[model samples]
Target: MTGDIAFGAGWQKTIRVGRDYISVKLDDPSFAASVYASLAETDNGDYALIWSR
Candidate 1:
């Protein structure tokens, strides 16, 4: 969570509740590509992924 998350962005999301903390990162481009390819092979129809703050 301390590295590049996008073209020029870094460490995009951080959250803490009580004594716990969490950091999130964007999926690696290659991994994302592979996921999309696998999804295509399944022909699961169109879908959408949404993220919001």
Candidate 2:
């Protein structure tokens, strides 16, 4: 349940939360849905949901 995610390019960044979760932030609001969807694809019950604000 511990890993590192490199967002690669663009204005997005990832913040690691200890060894359990990661917080993704998108500077370009347009990529919110896309990013959320991508992360959601990897959901395996370890997480509740991939959300954006």
Candidate 3:
């Protein structure tokens, strides 16, 4: 799996991971869930304007 942060005003900035497996079995769902949980309370901490995709 791979992670990237992109900032410039316009873009998907999505998390991209390449693998030989099916897309449905992509990056750890648990991991993503943890991440979302951690950030959900940020309340715009992303307001720093840095895009972490």
TM-score for each model:
0.21, 0.25, 0.16
Candidate 2 per-residue C-alpha lDDT over 1-53 given as tens digits, one digit per residue, 9 for 90 to 100: 98985553333334364234444444444454434322322345654446554
By TM-score rank, best first, the candidates go 2, 1, 3
lDDT of 1 by residue, 1-53 (tens): 49744622223332253322223334555654321111111236553333332
Most TM-score-accurate candidate: 2
**Looking at candidate 2, what is the lDDT of residue 19?**
35
Using lDDT as the measure, the top candidate is 2
In order, the Cα lDDT scores of the candidates are: 0.32, 0.43, 0.27
Model 1 residue 31 lDDT? 53
**Residue 45 alpha-carbon offset, candidate 1, angstroms:** 45
Report how far residue 52 has shifted in candidate 1, in Å: 18
- Residue 23 of candidate 3: its Cα lDDT? 15
- Write model 3 residue lDDT over 1-53, tens digit each, in one string: 89984321222322345212111212244444321111121345432222232
Single out the weakest 10-residue window by summed lDDT for candidate 3.
Answer: 33-42
Worst 10 residues of 2 by lDDT: 34-43
Q: Relative to the unseen true structure, what is the Cα RMSD of model 2? A: 10.8
User: Which prediction has more favorable TM-score, 1 or 2?
Assistant: 2
| lDDT of the structure predicted as candidate 1 | 0.32
